[model samples]
Target: LTCERYPVRRLPFSVVSEEDLASFERIVPGRVVTDPEELEASNVDWLRTMRGCSKVLLKPRTTEEVSCILRYCHGRNLAVNPQGGNTGLVGGSVPVFDEVILSTALMNQVISFHSVSGTLVCQAGCVLEELSRYVEERGFVVPLDLGAKGSCHIGGNLATNAGGLRLLRYGSLRGTVLGLEAVLADGTVLNCLTSLRKDNTGYDLKQLFIGSEGTLGVITAVSILCPPKPGAVNVAFLGCPGFAEVLQTFSACKGMLGEILSAFEFMDAECMRLVQHHLLLACPVQESPFYVLVETSGSRAEHDAEKLGGFLDQALGSGLVTDGTLATDQRKVKMLWALRERITEALSRDGHVYKYDVSLPLDRLYDLVTDLRARLRPPAKHVVGYGHLGDGNLHLNVTAEAFSAPLLGDLEPYVYEWTAGQRGSVSAEHGVGFRKRGALGYSKPPEALQLMQQLKTLLDPKGILNPYKTLPVQA
Candidate 1:
């Protein structure tokens, strides 16, 4: 049924026979899940747009167990889907067909942490929020923060190279992650998990798997550099009269706040309405065309507060911000953040959401959403835009009563072409999973795609690891 909605011919790979299940049981005894009821959740993605019929789910606790399982699967010529958290917006986390689901759920462990250096080495399956708590207790904070931090695994985050709220201050996972250990297609363990920040010995092999989306290998362990937890943190929720004013406010924010600025996120009025209507969230500021959430983190509370207050005064004085509310306490900070972070959940509740994550020039970030709202008049229930403005990532979401092929037809090539025209990324934070594999050409050239295919082939000769993901199928 899923295949009917998103058609793909199943590749020739061995199906799971009784002997195969028996071998998997020996590899990860008592962890091989085959029951359909239990597999239901694992087979579906977080967005619920993609579904798979994977018969076997393998949960391994250690890299050795994962290596052994991949080794066995490689020999059997069976397709293996390496999954983590299963919170991927793309269909990459879920098996497209009957591929054996190799999950890192049971590999949750903190391998090591250096308090002085603030380097954290942890198992791939450790939840992001728990890791954040663990690091915060030691006076450090994880470089990234996502809406699904409570459930999304560190491995999954690395696999997708997730750029979240704190990316503005901390940079991407590719920069924060010092090293990692991954299990290759043939079960060879590539152990580059070093805590050292500067290592230019040779080819940075770990970078290959950071955003490869599991098509290259399964990331087992990671060593990341966490920044020291800020002594003072503040959140400002402001309403902007228009998109231009929002841009002006961000410019002023960066200028005034300087290094203390941690994040700059924006959402249209439509997104705020959806959040209020569906999630029962209250608007902290007066209603306006656009809203911006600015965050500050610094070592000195008084100095940080002064800088933030100055930035706010400048924004309000310049007519960049219509109305605003600043929060110094943790409760208010969290409340302000919830309005931006929960936009995805609110949009989902409204109707079937067609989500697109793109990176455009800052000035043209919100243009696509406005264009779509005008284009899809009758079918589209709502077209909203929201995302990290500092990083130039736009989350354009369109909702309809339900999924319709005609509606999708109106969005596709048009959206991709518009992104390509601006020389922007079609998939900014989210990797090119099964759903966006075909659109890879929009972002990458043919030669790049060819080289990507070559890398996939060299790393996974049999194409047994996460087939139908990341790279586009060559015609």
Candidate 2:
């Protein structure tokens, strides 16, 4: 099968023969899947944007099985695509050609959890939400959280170095993920799974695989440092009359409640319209040009509530906020958070999505969306912007009834060039999967790109791991 939107010729990798299938069956037994019906879902990505046509899928249960599968595949010079939850927004987790699909679905197991240090050691396939519940019961919380937590695997999160709502408080996975175990292309297991908080060991080998998008190695297990569950949590959804007010309110928030602030997210009025129209979710606050979601987590309920109230009062009195609604109850908090978290789902229901995740200087974060809206309104259904305002990331999305080549042409180099002009990142939290591979140069210099290629060559000399993804084509 050929990818029409992103055309690519098949690479010169060895095709899977009967002997390969038999060997895979011997390794995974009943877990080798070749039926067309069974392989359909794993062939596509979460955004439904990319599809692959792999003939085999292997479900490995343990690290040993993963090593054996890779070792055999490497010996035969077969391309292997490592898959986790398949919840990636980019086309990273799926195969672009007839590569062997190595899935971690059966590797879901929590090995250990230290109650005092709040370190969680688990197999790669453990679902993020499941791990969250497991740690919450033990008075701790997973350091990261996103809309796809219900289905996203911790392995995929590490593969992308995912940063979600709690990132403002807990920071990125690169810091929280203290150690990990990964299997290289030659089936050598790099066991670095340690739970230590401090280790000045010569080289942090785990960092190489954290955001490599499964190109360097297949992550088998992870040891992450979880933070203690806060005693109190509060969410406030506020409406701003303009983007200036939204920025002012954020400044006020940091000045007043920075210590306990957990998240600061903002969305345009268009995003609110889509969520309300498609998801049937009611907005918690009054109608306004912009909206912001503020969350606070702290040790004492009364103290956190008082601080949030003071921040809100100052924001409203200073004309930084026009209307707002606060939630302390669990049910209400979820409802409020849904308005921001479910924007991706709502956009999907609208039509084809041209999704772009970038990091810009806070002052110019929303300008790209405004420029695009003016440039492509007739052909574009909606051009909206929203993301983790605390971290200066923008999720600029455009929708239409269907994908159009001309529309994509209008978005490409323009968006990348604008982001580059502002000295911003083109991929942001989303790793450089197939879709963004060619755009890597817009974010990194020639020297950096050359070093990345050297590293990819060093790790997988045969280029058998997740080929046609991440790195850009060389000149």
Candidate 3:
């Protein structure tokens, strides 16, 4: 039924017969999971939009184990889905139908950490937050931070090229991840996991798998450059009279807070209302048309505080911020952050949620949410907008009592068309999983998509790796 709902047809891949399970067991003994109950979570995605009937789930702990499983699957022309944390918004993390699920749950291990260089080498299955804590304890910090950090794995984050809260400061993982270890589709081990910050080789081959969404290879381990942990951090929750004022405030932040500004995020009142209604989390600032969360991280507490204090004072004095609150301590900072980070949870509690993560010019970012609010009229419970304002990414969400076809009909190509009109990306951080493959052209040109297809064929000639996903369906 789930397969019928989508457009993709089953590829000419082998079904997991008992013989295949036996072969997989030999590669990772005691780890071949076939229990339907155990396979349930892996089959469903984070947003519950897609489901797959994967009959077999393989847990491989080492590079050799992964290489063996992939080699066998590739040789037999069996479809495979590589899963990590299963917290992706797009429908890419699960099998579309009966593809085998290759999980990285057992591959978690810290390979090495160099304190002086702030470099960390770790297995792909290592949880992002755990690595954050590990590095923080060693006087460094993971350059990336996201809401699902507690559960999302480092490999998944890199697989999706996740751009989270810290991108405004440390930049995307493409810049921070020095090297990686990946297994090619046909079982060749490609190890480029070097801890160097600067290396100009013939070609940066590891970059291919960074955001390929597992269609090219399975990322086994990564070597990344970590910045030293900031000694001082500050959070400010502010309310703005309108979107224009929000823009002015962000301009002020980039000018005054420049180097220390770690993140600049914005949300509409609809988002705040849902956070209060479902999660019962009270809004920290007085009600306003728009809200912004500005975070600053620096080396010296006194210096950062003085800089933040002046920034806030100027924002208020210029009426850039209608009202605001600042928190310097850790607990209060997290509580305020919960206002932004817990939005996905609140949206979930509302009901079935249709999420759109897009990149647009800051001036035009909120326009789509506004456009949909007018067009959808009713039935759509909420048309909420919020996201990393600093990076020009917006998380547009629409919730209803349940999934509705008419509502979807009104949203689909219209949203994609609007994004194309602005020359914006249909997906910013979330990779083009199954559901979004059709819209990949809105962001990437035909030539770019062609090149991507050529690369996919070259790296995964069998078309057995993550089949029916990532690549655009028609082209």
Q: What is the TM-score of each candidate against the true structure?
A: 0.99, 0.99, 0.98
Candidate 3 on 232-282: residue-level lDDT in tens? Answer: 999999999999899989999989988999999999999999888888888
By lDDT, is 2 or 3 better? Answer: 2
lDDT of each: 0.93, 0.93, 0.92
Clashing pairs in 2: none
How does candidate 3 score on lDDT?
Answer: 0.92
Kindly report which residue pairs in candidate 3 clash with one another. none
- The deviation in Å at residue 77 for candidate 2 is 1.0
What's the TM for model 2? 0.99
Q: What is the lDDT of residue 188 in candidate 1?
A: 98
